[model samples]
Target chain A: LAKTTQPISMDSYEGQEVNITCSHNNIATNDYITWYQQFPSQGPRFIIQGYKTKVTNEVASLFIPADRKSSTLSLPRVSLSDTAVYYCLVVGMDTGRRALTFGSGTRLQVQP
Target chain B: EAGVAQSPRYKIIEKRQSVAFWCNPISGHATLYWYQQILGQGPKLLIQFQNNGVVDDSQLPKDRFSAERLKGVDSTLKIQPAKLEDSAVYLCASSSRDRAQNIQYFGAGTRLSVL
Candidate 1:
């Protein structure tokens, strides 16, 4: 399992672009970076995932560099509903067992 | 097409009491996971199951907690003599085996409050 570090909190206004970065210096070659969004009183939902470079989805975008040591989740035109904790996970796909290790997560507050 | 389902959305019990949570994973999912999420913290993986066999349970408190996935469909998690520190949300998630990425679908979770 790889450990990830991210900002404790971030504040952004509605309709603005919010980028949350996570650092996983020990990321292995078989590891993939994944992001999840968790709202109050709800389970975390998958936002986006990337092995390297960038991957875009209907909800968010993920950017990874060549080193694979860090990745960023970009949310475009944020709204108040986007206020929630965002978790960055480094998961290994080679293993038969699959489970995510979540950190404290970055709490994004989309203010009006 | 249905997502994971969990029963007893909320539970309130006194200290030293026992509580059980049930989870029904999405159809055809081969892997299941149990996590514990405390207030102001992210969800922590408690155990992982592949069908009816246990994969990883390193973080599970075996002395007081027990879980089973009989017949490889639904799972039950029980905590004996709960403590105040055990007050947290228990989450259940599942994922398919064919997908290249480990994308897990989660349930609404069972919130346990130890009073």
Candidate 2:
């Protein structure tokens, strides 16, 4: 598993776009970057995942550079409900045998 | 479809006592994982199972913790002679490789308090 680094905390207002970056300097070729959102007293929820380039889903977008050392999770039009901790993880995507290892995460506080 | 289910959402026990948590993954998900999250910290993988067989348990404290996924569906995790440091949320998650993406669905988790 590749360790990830992210900001400890970030502040954003409602209707703003929030982007959290994760750095996995030792990412492997078989590794894929994944993002998960966690609110207070709840388990982490999968947000988006990508191996390379950019991947967008109904909830958020994930951008990976060519080097794959870092990735960013972008949340559009944030709302008070979007206040949560965002986690960045790099997992080995082979044969689906690998499990996720979460980090301290970036706490995004969305103010109304 | 229903999501992962866990019971005894909250538990409080004295140190050295035993506790068990149950988890029923989403139907048809072959992979299940148990994680422990301490306050202000990220979740740490304790074990991983595939179809009733364990894939990883290196992080588990085998002497005190045990888990089983009999029948390849529902699972249980147990801890005996628990220590104060063992107080944390135990999370159960399941994922299927049907899409080549291991997107896990998590249960609300069992919060354990060791006094």
Candidate 3:
């Protein structure tokens, strides 16, 4: 079974901010939350990852609270190209098990 | 600096027939993984390899699916008796443990259509 849960779909207008949240209540302490974006007919592309608190990169920002039960991926000023499936993955560091278990992604539709 | 590579971008085969997909990871990568992505769902890990040895394949259906990385660089995934439900995009990804993060880079994937 997948360790993460996300919405099946979301809608947003161009230039607006989009936030997608994922719940991983069973996340372990050594687990790190990573996000990826997948365009139609293409493989997934890495977005951002975080263990705790907040992690900001050029593409997006990841926010995690103290409980670490959930995390949010924030996209600033969304565009039509941002319309794609977003996946949240829990990676166990140093576990030597780098295999990723993906869940049903959240489809974000960005309209003009 | 080349990314993970997979061959036969598209394939169409009849059920019960055999098919194979090949992948070559980025140079110096010690870890390789194969995933199956059904339409309308996320990718599922089929198998994982660490330098020519199987590290994980609990999700793989051993009844029909098999994989190997002989040279610890290139790998192949084969299905002996394909089924209709086996139609999906097969993706190969590789990552380096030498780095601090375990970020995996994916290939374009091979779309298999089993009729």
Candidate 4:
């Protein structure tokens, strides 16, 4: 499993774009970068995932540079309801036998 | 489609007692996972199951923890002689067939308190 490091916490205002970056220097070729959002008392929900370059979804965007050493999660127009812990995961593309290894997620506080 | 479901939303037991949690994954989801989340920490994977077989359980304390996905649809996780440190939320999650692009859907989780 690839080890990931991210900020402990961050603060942002509503309607602003928030970027959370994660570093996984030891990522393998088969590994993919995935992000999850978790609200208090609920299970984490997948926000976006990317193998390289950038991928955009209705909720967020993921940017991975050439080195794959790090990736960024961009949430556009943040809202108070977006306050939650964001987890970055590096796992193999093989789904059948893979289990997620979660890291200390970055807690985003979307203030009004 | 219904999401993953875990039973016994909350459990409080004395040390040395036993506790069990149940999970029902999405109707056709072939992969299931159990994770333990301690307060102030991200969830740790305890076990993973693919259908009725064990895919990964390296983190599970086999000596005291055991889990089974008998029918490949519903599963159970048990802890015998629970300890105080076992107090945390046990979460169950499921994903669709395409593992790479698939998103994991999680249940509310079972919060256990071992005194």
Candidate 5:
């Protein structure tokens, strides 16, 4: 399984573009990179997913380099409501091909 | 288009006690997933069901945890002789069968506190 590493927390101001980067040095070719946002007491919500290059959506943009070792999740003009934990996930089937292994996520704090 | 529904939003039990959580996926989705979210961590997948069949359950702790999806619509996750380490939020999510764009829809989740 490919594990992800990210900063424990980040502090940003509202209206600023916040970028959270995740490193998966051992990412497999068949794996997919995904980002999820989670609010307090709520299940994590999908934000964006990508194989490589740049993929933009209504909520965020995902940038994956050619090396595929790391990916960046960009939230444009973030607001206080965006203050939550952001998780970077490498989706790959386990040996038995059942569940997704989640790692420790990055907590984003948007200050006014 | 009702979203995924999970019952008993909260549960508290002592070690050695048993508990069960229920989930009803989206109206037409064929895939359902159960995940465990510990505080300060991302949700870990416990099991996956493709319709009424089990797709994956390697991460589930079989010693005390078990889950089943009957009729391919509603599902249940049970923990027998719960342990303090079992304290976490249990989330139910669903996705369509398409290979591309497998976006998962999640419920509010059931928070369990094992004493």
Candidate 6:
């Protein structure tokens, strides 16, 4: 498994765009970058995933460079409810296994 | 579809006591995972099961924690002689191998407080 590095915390105001970057210098050929959002007293929810380039969903957008060394998660027009801890993970797709390693995610505080 | 289900949403016990948590994965999900989340930290994988067989338990404290999945549907994680450091949230997640995506659906989790 490749290790990931992200900010410990970030502060954003409502209606602003927030971008969280994650670094995975040792990312492998089959590794994919995924992000998850966790709220207080709730389980972590999948936010977005990308192999390379850009991937957008209804909730967020993931941008990955050609080197795949790093990726960015962009949340547009943030709301106070979007305040939560966001996790960045690098998982291998070569095997059918489904175990994930999580780090001390980036805590995003959305202010009103 | 219903998400993963976990029982005993909250548990409090004294050190040296035993406690157990149950989890029911989403329908047709062949892979199940158990994780421990300490305060101010991210969730750590404790065990992973594929069907009725164990896939991985490298991070599990086998000396005191044990888990079993019956008939490849439900699972139970037990901790005997719990310690104060055992206080944390136990999370259960599941995903289907049939899907190419590795998305996992997580349960609310069981909060354990060992005093």
Best by lDDT: 3
**Chain B TM-score, structure 1:** 0.96
- lDDT (10s digit) by residue, model 5, range B26-106: 999999999998887778889889999988787899999999999999999999989999999999999997232477888
Off by over 4 Å in 4: A92-99, B98-100
Tell me the TM-score of each prediction against the true structure.
Answer: 0.92, 0.93, 0.94, 0.93, 0.93, 0.92
Q: Best candidate per DockQ, number?
A: 4
Clashes of 6: 0
Better of 3 and 5 by TM-score: 3
Evaluate model 6: give its lDDT: 0.87
Per-residue lDDT over A1-112 for candidate 1, one digit per residue giving the tens place of the 0 to 100 score: 5466899999999999999999876666675787889987888898888899999988899999998988999999999999999998775322444445675699999989
Residues A1-112 of candidate 3 have per-residue lDDT tens digits of 4366899999999999999999876666666788999998888999998889999999899999999888999999999999999998774322444435575899999999
Interface DockQ per candidate: 0.62, 0.57, 0.59, 0.67, 0.62, 0.59
Q: Cα deviation of B37 in candidate 1 (Å)? A: 0.3
lDDT of 3 by residue, B78-108 (tens): 9989999999999999988523258888999
**How do the residues A1-112 of candidate 2 rate in per-residue lDDT, one tens digit apiece?**
5366899999999999999999877665776778999988888999999999999999899999999988999999999999999988675322444545676799999888
Q: List the residue pairs that clash in candidate 1.
A: none
Per-model lDDT = 0.87, 0.87, 0.88, 0.87, 0.87, 0.87
Instruction: Name every residue pair that clashes in candidate 2.
Output: none
Question: Can you tell me which runs of candidate 3 are displaced by over 4 Å?
Answer: A92-99, B98-100
lDDT of 4 by residue, B33-99 (tens): 8999999888888988889888789789998999999988999999997999999999999887535
- Give a tens-digit lDDT track for model 4, residues A10-110: 99999999999998766667667889999988888888889999999999999999998899999999999999999987753233435456768999999
Interface RMSD of each: 2.1, 2.3, 2.4, 1.6, 2.2, 2.3
